[model samples]
Target: MNALFLTFLFPLIGFLLLSFSRGRLGENLSALIGVGSVGLSAATSAWIIYQFNVAPPEAGVFTQQLWVWMSVEGFAPSFTLHLDGLSLTMLGVVTGVGFLIHLFASWYMRGEEGYSRFFAYTNLFIFSMLLLVLGDNLLLLYFGWEGVGLCSYLLIGFYYSNPNNGNAALKAFIVTRVGDVFMAFGLFILYMQLGTLNIQELLTLAPQKFAAGDPWLTLATLALLGGAVGKSAQLPLQTWLADAMAGPTPVSALIHAATMVTAGVYLIARTNGLFLLTPDVLELVGIVGGVTLVLAGFAALVQTDIKRILAYSTMSQIGYMFLALGVGAWEAAIFHLMTHAFFKALLFLASGAVINACHHEQNIFKMGGLWKKLPLAYASFIVGGAALAALPLITAGFYSKDEILWEAFASGNSELLYAGLAGAFLTSIYTFRLIFIAFHGEQKTEAHGGHGVAYWLPLSTLIVLSTFVGALISPPLAGVLPQSVGHAGGEAQHSLEIASGAIAIAGILLAAMLFLGKRRLVTAIAASAPGRFLGAWWYAAWGFDWLYALLFVKPYLLICRLLGRDPLDHAIGLIPATVRSSHEAMTSTETGYLRWYAASLALGAVVVLGIIVLA
Candidate 1:
């Protein structure tokens, strides 16, 4: 447990060293500091895991309190790290997958401008994310939460010279902040009501203080969900994620796969106690997840950019996790989160390799028959794509996704079950569609990039993890979180799994039919008026950006214009204006003239004599 703090410390040190270098350091040293630091963090995580397994902590939880953060009338949250199965799972993902992504970045970012700066931001990101998962209290968690947000802004706009990239970074920051505000209100409500921000204490006190379906409890959880939605890029807040591809591909991998987008899922699972008290908000969480998965699936279907497709896929996969959480399939949600990290990281890193190989071209349409030119990337895509599509028993995604589908089914939520099925179908279609169109067709661009040890090591490792081997490494969450209700584990579960697996295969077959070979069918469909309209709509992520502009952005700007100069400021200025005017008038009367002084004195005396006579 003592080694737990070292997980974040290594990356913190790396960030400091790299930041001080100011991009003056050579790429080798910078990579060593950046990638090596995360590797060390990963190593620390392994040691902690070994220790936790060798001698399980009391209550299957360990808390390391370094010092009391502050004490105010018995309200104190400490600088502490809490380790349990849940946080341990997230710790492994953040450090392990993060280390691999960092390694791939070393190769992907070679010869790029500000190379050291990129690694510095990524190291800081790893530090922030680790803090987020490992914190013992909500206040500390929120500090880490905001830390990751700031790092995301910095990394997403790593190419600050490009206005579009900067705008994308700002968009991600602003959108997530909307959720952060809601989460902040939720935290305030929790502390005000429970008198503690410590997570375990809050969980213990919540049920005693508030009955099930309590309005105040519901409000707090709902606000927390709002924060999750924005951070995870669900529903209206999701527009920023697709545009986030304006950054480099590794940044895309880091955000989509292991860090920023998964924060929402982690938040909900972490606060399962509060959510369990508010069933309605929990159901809403499921609805948001269900609807988002379907919508993002459709959006992925029409995307042309290599990364945007994967971006929408990330959103859709997270939607599945949300759906699982909403259904009280807590472990299932977490399980999918873990498995998604494996495959999604593989896909993004491989996509980066492909882009670099093809001279940085990202259009799937522009990259065809590349399987021969780049066999390693091609294999990476196949393995990663199969896992993403959840192609039956061979891929890790099938096991995790099927668990979610079964949970939805077992919960007897027909609507959610259907949504999960549909999203799965859509996921398979678009995933294989990308693979077929990008890898199988005639070669459209000349592909040439050296396949060094840097490229193969990380990509190969991820490829292995994306397979069924990764599925075997389950999160030890049996006692940590509540056991899932409604898990019958009978023929019914098998039937649903088989059915869902069939649906996945069907979607892949459809993708092959449509995208493989000549792609005339997809082309014709695209050329049709209705197809064109639908494609555009889906491609714009169901017109969310437009709707937000109309509903929120436009009105805000219009109000700003109407105000012109704040009327309250003008009103407050009147007292100062009057004082200044009187001062000027009195100053004019004080002219240096003896006659004027004598006249004033005579007037005063006359007034005095008049008053005396009257008296």
Candidate 2:
């Protein structure tokens, strides 16, 4: 447990040393510190996990109580780290994938201007995510939650000289804050109703204290879902992530692959008991996941920027996780979460290599046939794309994603299953659309070739993970989780698995037909007005952002402008001047003269008597 605690400390220390040194440490040293700390943390996590597997905690859980955080009357909450299969699973993703990203970043960010500052933020993000997953109580989790939000804003706007980057950072911060508000309210409601913030306590107490369909419990669950929606980039709150690509590519990988976006899934999965009580809220989770996956999948299809394409893909894939959670496929959701991290990180890092090789060109339309120039990256991207499309059971994504589809179908919700299938199709189409357009076309630009081991190593590891990690880890993960969570087998019929695979193949062929050799139908479709409109709608994320702008952003901006001479200022102006004049008049009455005193007394007496007589 102490070693588990040290996992967070290493990154925290790394961030502090690098940040406070103020560039005196130089680029190479800063890079070493950042990557080294995360690597060490990963090592420490492995050791802790090894120990846990050996001894096993009582009831398969371990809690490290560092201090008594707060107490009032009979209420108390402590600074604690709760480790179980759930937290350990998340810890593994955060530390393991995070370390790989850091390594990839050490190369990707090599000599960037804000090199030290970049690593500082990266280390801090790891520490924050660790706290977020490792916390034992809601307050501690919120602390880490807000920490990651702040760190994300900093990292996203790392190139702050550009106003667009700054605006993007602010957009992410403000949009996520909307969900955080709901989460805060949810916490308050839960506390008021249940009188506890400790997660295990709440999990134990909620069902015992409240019956199924309790309104207060439902509201609390819904509120928490709002937070998940914002963080996970589920519907309505997903607009920020596409813009978040303004940061360094490694930051994009970190956020989309391992950290902030996955927080919502972890949150929902952690409090499975609470949600199980509210069937309606569970259904809402599936609805949000299903709708978001479809919309984001559409958005990914039309995106030109490589990172933004991956961004929308990240959103859609998270939707699958949400769908799994909704259907009580907890193990499936977590499995997808892990596999998605491996493949998505691989895609992002490989995309970084492509972008670098092409002199920072991010538009997939501009990149062509790097199959020879940067064969490693090209092959890695294919693997990532294959995994993303869940190219039949060979890739990690097939095993995980098909499980979600099966779970959705097994739940007997035709709508969810159909939506999941649609999302799968869209996912495959866009994933290979980018692949075929970028990898199979005539060389549009000459690419500067050759990357160091620093670049190739991470991609190779992730390529392997994306190809096979799901099958390797899914069964072990199932054993790790509670039995009631639902497994990949049993009622998750084989027929549905075949159907999901066929749909994935159909999408790949569709992408190849439209984008690869002869793009005849795609060209004809692009020429039509209806096709143009649909493309625009998909590009705009189905106008959800527009609706939000009209509903929230425009009114907010208008209010800010109106506040230049705020109504409060006018009312305040009236009060202060009137007070000053009345004070001056009163000062005149305070003169040390018998006549003035007598006059004041007489006036006061006259006014008092007049009022008394009227009464």
Candidate 3:
């Protein structure tokens, strides 16, 4: 078997083992398998990267075919793996960071009753995500897409005993399903038009086969965008991600930060050739991403819960990535994806450590002055926060996010550029707002105390990576993508870097002034109408449960009542009544007495003879 298969296979093996063990395995053994599987996959991914560097695939791509998985009516979808710079980058991030999160979870979830089950779901999520990145064709990709959705639902509701968690998971599944339906239709249209689902072949044929403004291409692109939007928690479909903070912190790190959410960005980047064919659709992507960026950033600004703040922040950062992909900056988008996976995962895990130490307290107002006690977590949080805030000359987020902003400005999409800049400012403000409020305030609650090295070790490792990984991508990523795609300039200039750095610093200062230096200012603002609106998520999320109740539950009950009296029951009852009448009529035709049976038989014979004579 090829190494690509092993990347997916090992996690699946862990899932199966842990699943079968059913909470029976010793805690140590369960943790080992869970972490080990992803660790091995990470090692395998590194080897694959080494091989690719040594003997780079033609045009920076490689393919491995497993077998013909299915065929129908001259259409065949194979179980194949395609490796390229794109897939390789994603593989390393998913398995590498994924392994770290798993290890972190082992310590984080040490005393939880469902420790084994938690690992099982985590491994399964890894397996699905690997399949998503490694798949060669659309069918296989869809399989992986749904697989990850299932895993997400399972992991989000890992604490099944909690009704709120279950509801959150269901909401995620249902909302994403709406998008997945469109994605499925889009895939069907592609196969019907192109006659193949192989991504490489599709890319090769897409340019010549489809016209620049073809309606089918536009529709297909939009449909696929729907999927991306839902998965990435873009505007209108973003509510679930905020609610998903109900899951364990490691789950948040793995799913929201590193793996599951990035799939959407990956989808757009992987299909750059198809998207390039449709400029209108590309513009739509920019518009949606830009709007989502602004909306989510504002949402992040007011959230009190630490994870909800990160959740909204994740949405905003993903919006930037989408903006990059939208403006034809594929390489920059993927670069940001990598940087995001590192720092966001770090931030979430570090937050988890803090939340654990504080006895499950997540309210930023309740947390303060633990920087001295949980020094490692504090340090990791700072590294992650710097990356998030895009501080000058220090963090990965600065490099990747700044690159996207430059591309957006230089891409002839000025409106999008302006929106992106505003979002950037907000991003910086909200990120550090969380940092200063949570870490820099006076201690209000008693510290529940800190943990052993096992807890801090994974967070520290991520912190180091978060600080450094941004610079590694320029050479490899810039080399692959065409110059026309990224920005007007060939590479990032010092002046542009300084300007972005300045914007970031300004945002930080502004946040400090409003939330920290002048606390009364924020309080006064919150007393005002606009601040109230901001706190309420601009009313987008207000009465959400009630809206669901009125729209889904109350309406369903009304329909049930109406149907019960007027239509549904009566219509349904008619079928059984008609069957009963038919049975009674047939019973009359059949006589219980032997003499009646004989007479009927004789009558039938006489009738047949008469008909024959007449003919």
Model number with the top TM-score: 1
lDDT of 2 by residue, 274-348 (tens): 898999999999999999998889889888999999999999999999999998888888989989999999999
Ranking by TM-score: 1, 2, 3
lDDT of every model, 2 decimals: 0.92, 0.88, 0.84
Cα lDDT tens digits, model 1, 1-615, are 788899999999999999898878999999999999999999999999888889999999999998999998898889999999999999999999999999999999999999999998998989999989999899999999999899889988989999999999999999999999999999999998999988999899999999999988999999999999999999867888998898889999997666779999999999999999999999999999999999999999999899999999999999999999999999999999999999999999999999999998999999999889888888998999999989889999999999999889888899999999999999999999998988887999999855778889988998999999999998989888888876778998888889989999999999989988888998999999999999989988889899999999999999998787788878999999999999999889998999999999999999999999999
Q: After aligning candidate 1 to the native by TM-score, how far in Å is the CA of 48 from where it should be?
A: 1.1
What residue runs in model 3 are displaced by over 4 Å at the alpha carbon?
A: 473-475, 478-482, 486-494, 539-561, 564-568, 574-615
**In candidate 1, how many Å is residue 536 off?**
1.2
Worst 10 residues of 1 by lDDT: 448-457
Off by over 4 Å in 2: 72-74, 475-492, 565-568, 571-615
Sum up the clashes in candidate 3: 0
The true-structure Cα RMSD of candidate 3 reads: 5.3
Write model 3 residue lDDT over 78-125, tens digit each, in one string: 898988777888888899889888888888998998999999998998
Q: Estimate the TM-score for candidate 2.
A: 0.91
TM-score of 1: 0.93
Assess the local accuracy of residue 505 in candidate 1 as a C-alpha lDDT between 0 and 100.
Answer: 94
lDDT of 1 at 50: 86
The per-prediction tally of clashing pairs is 0, 0, 0
Check candidate 2 and list the clashing pairs.
none
